[model samples]
Target: MESDSETHSGEDTTPDDWMDLAVDSPDGSPAASPAATQKPSEEEDFKLSLITWNVDGLDLEKRPERSRGLVKYLNLHNPDVVFLQELVPPYVQFLKEQLVNYLMIEGGRNGCFTGMLLKKSRVKLVESEMVAFPTTKMRRNLLVAQVIVNGQKLCLMTSHFESCKENTAERLKQLHVVKRRLKHAPDDVTIVFGGDTNLRDAEVTKVGLPATVCDVWERLGKQEHCRYTWDTSANNNKTFPFVARCRFDRIYLRPAIKRGIPRLAPDHMALVGLEKLDCGRYTSDHWGIYCTFSAE
Candidate 1:
């Protein structure tokens, strides 16, 4: 692991400045970054599983079908915490019913609230708050929960970053809010941040964070791999939809190491059209990224 001090050795000394990091693909291979000469030991212990997904519209009535599917999926994996994006209050109420024993906390503005539904018997929500940014038009909020999972304290953050286009400096400033929040979190707590970042390949350069926190997907090292969170069938490799395959939804973990966990989604849900353009049929434009870690 590269230290924050080491990563900052090069130029780009601006506060929000970030180096162009070459990340890995989904297949546990190196992509934009140089391949590692040696791999880590497989016997390393201490694991936890995390799932990040955008439940599309989260329509209270029609989308409960998707909610039902999601509940069942969680029951199977039973992650310590689930980071969800785009869940409206009504849908949260519906999910509350479906997930009878779980405690729910929501943050952010209307359309982009981030939520965490924790199994009541398994975890306890100790503290939480919203990340307010002065420069942002719509305050991008983060729901942070201090949870006790199997006798362990895990800090889970549900975040939805800014999306509307603007100058690189502004975007970087917004991203700094995310970084500063994570950096300021209690050092003793085991922290994990996940959600829809709305970042394209080019925008990845703007994110700045301590080395203790890493983009899980970037650790894999195979950047060119067929890894895209959104479907861009209509756009011709342009601004909005950068490439044929684009992954805007992201999950960033602190204290948890990268171990490839299978991507599990609602059983019946499928993308009928482009991932982003909801055509009134498909559940969501983005697919879920599921990763597992050992609790022991």
Candidate 2:
């Protein structure tokens, strides 16, 4: 658990100004593979990266330039897939136009905004749907998509949750619903689930994902310099507005994908994963995560 000193720093923000992968193998049979239980390779061959961000109240009236910058930043990574929360409809179209190569899809009511973007060059969507929250039921929708990455079948889940500390239970229920929907999915197909979890340690443990799940940030350990993911430079450690942010947005992969191709894929040498994009230049209330993977 982070100490109050850590919590009070305003590293993680909600709403308002606070705000906000991969490779190729080939198409295969629908049958599930034993991929989930496979071990991590001595050396990772494929590279894939993912970013989960909660754009703070994005709309036509809001930060259009920042929004446009975000689209460019995402394009920089050319992420195999991107999960975003707090998306307004117009902003969604804006991103799709800019990310013309991406197959864009979103859900969670018309206003709540949660969606996923897949690079057109890598994957095609086979199916998609939404899971709405209990309280905001129709207000916040969970968007799930099955995509073919590097020729392997994969699942991407994106979402935003009801605000406030008390909504934690409802949020957990939402996560479970997401799991249940994918229960029948082949364990071999890689699963990347993330969005604005709206949770610190207080709520994560309660969700209790199956043993197969792994949060990339936590798995990477706390000693790393870019650990935090929420907040701006004013809130950062003071070097850069985007530096020293907290970890809020995230990318969690199932055992299969993590083992098949576990590497940080980035455009920047500092953000090495896959693709060639610079990350430090762009500033956002939330930072992004990118990891690359390959099929076995």
Candidate 3:
């Protein structure tokens, strides 16, 4: 975890917002042939660099030029997939222009949208859908997509849960709904579902479905690794410095079968997009985070 994560700014703005490749021989080669197609290495089998960010749509409205920096950051970091919340038209349009190689699947309307940006050059999109939680007034939505990479099917679901501590029940219900949905995904695919949960340790711990989903941050033994995503102390966002700072953004993995559990390489995990512009302003109110996942 970065010490700069000491205090994330902007509370409950919930609605507001990989690995090296090993080339395998294409020929139907055998391991012994030394020239035939070889089995995909674990890194090649499940390699993924995933990011989740809540871009504080409201903040972007004030400083829209930041979009350029956002685009530049994405290009520089270049994660394979990005989960975004509180997306606005300009930002979406900017991404379309800048991230021309990505397949952007957006959900919801202008005010509060959620979506995923999959790198078309890296993964093949097989299917997709969007989901809405029934019990919340916040009108959050989840974006789902299935992509094939290196012949492995991965179910990717990103969501923005109910916002504010007041909607704790709704968030919990949403988690249960997500857990139940993931619990039934076809066994042939690896499941990963997460986004702006608007949740803290208190409620998240209760969202127990160990056999299904596990917080990858915890798997790395860095529970507070995500603390600065929405910290008040880190930036000059509207929130007062004393306001509580916690990470509302997250990414989790659900092992479809015991055989497909993951091994998270620590080097690829960290909070990103926190760099200050030459003008000393942040790229966004939220700091993006990403991790590399490979089958164990």
Runs off by more than 4 Å, candidate 3: 1-46, 60-62, 223-225, 258-267
Instruction: Give the higher-lDDT candidate: 1 or 3.
Output: 3
Top-down lDDT ranking: 3, 2, 1
- lDDT (10s digit) by residue, model 3, range 185-269: 8776777776888888888778776575677776677656565578777766565737667777776776556455443333356
Scored by TM-score, the top model is: 3
CA lDDT of each candidate?
0.54, 0.55, 0.66
Candidate 2, residues 1-296, lDDT tens digits: the string is 11011101111222333222111124532211123223324342255556667765443333555565566566555556777777765566556544556667756334546667776655678887665555664366567787766556677887776555677677677667766644555756777777776666656676666666666666655436545555554332124533444456655666453345432223221122212223323334555555555432
Residue 24 error for model 2, in Å? 29
Residue runs of model 2 more than 4 Å from their true location after superposition: 1-45, 59-62, 179-184, 232-246, 257-283, 294-296
Candidate 1 regions exceeding 4 Å error are: 1-46, 58-62, 108-112, 167-170, 223-226, 233-244, 256-281
In terms of lDDT, which candidate is strongest?
3
Q: Which ten residues in a row have the lowest lDDT in candidate 2?
A: 1-10
lDDT of 3 at 284: 75
